[model samples]
Target: IYHVNNWYGVGVGSVVFYNDAIDANTDRSLYRKDHVYTTADKIRAGVALNNEFKFGLITAMVDWGVYLYNPARHYYDNPEHPIYGLGRRPLFYKNDGAGSDEAFHYIRFGMKTRIWDNLYFSASAKTHLHICEYVEFGLGYQIPFLKKENRKHGEKIFHHRKNWWQE
Candidate 1:
């Protein structure tokens, strides 16, 4: 049996400014710069499966993930202001917190094999199946609890235990 879970959030904001003073006949081009704020949120869930085969010599695993975004609940809507409008028009501001919502989906498949004594290898492939997503792949090898043969020194002790905390 296997299980997994995950969650995350992202957001950003900026300030707006006006350069020129406002007068009855001031030109609209007098404004030099305007600022805007933006933000987004994302949530995700994941599930995984693992199995042991060939008397614990080989292992296989697969994981799938789904992400969702609420556009109505999160979106950016700010209009630019002209410099000449300053003082003439009542500045409007609201604390909408953040805007915009983006989503992503992903999956991963992997396998591991132990060939010959003291040798093990593993590989995995991961990918995103949605727009504005990314993918990655990885491979690894290692030998654990290896001891020299016919050593005259004090007896070497080896202990192997599963790490349940990683689950």
Candidate 2:
């Protein structure tokens, strides 16, 4: 991540494995597409871009991100195809290059808001081209694994009263 300023930053990354292992149902198998059911179920490397804006205790934050590749179980395209399991049908995840039906990439956008102190509530969506796969909600807690550095006291911005550290 490259911080554009005190409140903004940009990030890009390439990962050999980016599957949402956390989303997978441990009872199922990853090798079988029908068994695994997550928008990020693919086992391929991903290249992506993201940026964030933050201020103050960073409470109540809004965010957005762009991600390539779509996790396509293509269960809805045909009426005959059952929603669950491949049923002798081919798994649809790998991108088929540039084409309207199977587009190259998808977009991910979401927000995370602090509920109380270190606790947070998050909601996000995964859109494969124009198709929305799902909306996910989660709860998280920030563990202060590392002791915080002493913050510079009495910092003023735009002539406003000192803030962001007095808390």
Clashes of each: 4, 0
List ranges where model 1 is wrong by over 4 Å: 1-56, 66-103, 115-119, 130-167
lDDT tens per residue, model 2, 129-159: 6565468788988664333334433222211
Give the best candidate by TM-score.
Answer: 2
Lowest-scoring 10 consecutive residues by lDDT in candidate 2?
Answer: 152-161
lDDT of 1 at 13: 20
Candidate 1 lands at a TM-score of 0.26
Worst 10 residues of 1 by lDDT: 2-11
State the displacement of the C-alpha of residue 120, model 1, in Å, after optimal TM-score superposition. 3.9
